[model samples]
Target: MNNHIPILVEMQKLDDVIAEKLVLTESLPKRLSGLKKDVEDADNQVSETKTRLEENRKDQKLKELEIKSNNDQITKYKNQLLAAQSNKEYKALNSEVAHLESQNSLIDDVILQLMEDESSIKAQLEEELKIQANAKAELKANEDSLNLEIKEVEKEIKKFRDQRNNLAKDLPRALVKRYAALIKNRNRKAVVFNNGNKCGGCGYVLRPQVMIELQKGDEIINCENCGRMLVFHE
Candidate 1:
């Protein structure tokens, strides 16, 4: 009802938009971090798969070297069997050869299994690489746009805040101070519309006399419960 109410209402509108933009400013970086974390997670998956593949390859190499060494020892044993002078010596050499051949067979099976594991690891590596690529692309796609939106939101909030501050200059200092305190402490709602006989901000019951005074628009009337400046609404 006070003359300053209209100006205060206008300032509230600006402040509402500033508040909205400010929220966007806060959320944008969090969203960017989330997006970046996706890329990091995918990259880690790829790296882990590659490390497994590398380990598989190294194990295969070491196993192959073991087989080669066993084969060399078998050849030496065969030559010794040819030169053996006694029956016992020849039989011992023959036994050694057979044992070595059996060992080679087991080693071959191990090598085959290693090869199979290598194949599986390589396949997994390829899939992980693809996932990593897709995650990076997705981050690149969204990052720039989100950053731009964040900047734009910041600029808009600053602009709206400037307008609201300028408007405040035209109002009485004591009233502006009161409104600012309410806005800071009451979820940015220094002024609220009436919902029937209740305060819109806190649902506090408003008496008939207060409602009548609000309708009369003679002066500012704060809600008894919430202390917010009330605007009469249908």
Candidate 2:
């Protein structure tokens, strides 16, 4: 049996864990970005709703001013009706007052309609504000949870790295260097035990002589086809 096989296997296990940690770390940014996008979308919707409400308020104010102006005109025509001296003048003044009254009625109707629309818009704006507030709170809570999880993963990564470095010290200098090089090239999995005459990592068939040498396990043996460090266990 190869004396170093156990340590090499330990190293491989650590390497697998490191690979998983690195993948998980890399995926966090994408997840966070997705969350940020959702938050931004909600905020944008709220902003648009606020803008619409402001426009409705301005429209309502303009209609109110128009109604006030029409009321002022109605008062001015009423005074002129009281001051009319002749029948012809009285009739003309009456006609003018009637026209002003018609305009006032139209302005009043427009103001009423605008007031109703303003109330509806205000209600909608209030509902949207509530929704936005809820969404913001939920997003903040989710971000806090994700941050805690990332911290835990970072702690695990540190532990794995320390354990891997400590394990490397127990390996021979040459073997350690070779394993490090393989890990750099192959994403940390340097050695795998073969099943019979087949390489496990790449499933390449091993020669009988190579298989026998692997069983003795005195020295590190690499698969000729895949260049992965090979081990044999009976």
What is candidate 1's lDDT per residue for 1-234, written digit by digit as tens? 578888888888887887787788889999999989988998888888888888888888988888899899999999998899999999998998899889888988988998999899888888888888888898899999999999898888888889999999999999999999998998898888899999989999999999999888788889999999898787
Give candidate 1's error at residue 106 in angstroms.
2.0
Question: Once model 2 is optimally superposed onto the true structure by TM-score, how far is the C-alpha of residue 226 displaced, in angstroms?
Answer: 3.9
State the number of backbone clashes in model 2: 0
- Residue 17 of candidate 1: its Cα lDDT? 82
The TM-score between candidate 1 and the true structure equals 0.94
Residue 191, model 1, lDDT: 84
- As for candidate 1, its clashing pairs are 1-217
Off by over 4 Å in 1: none
- Score every model by TM-score: 0.94, 0.74
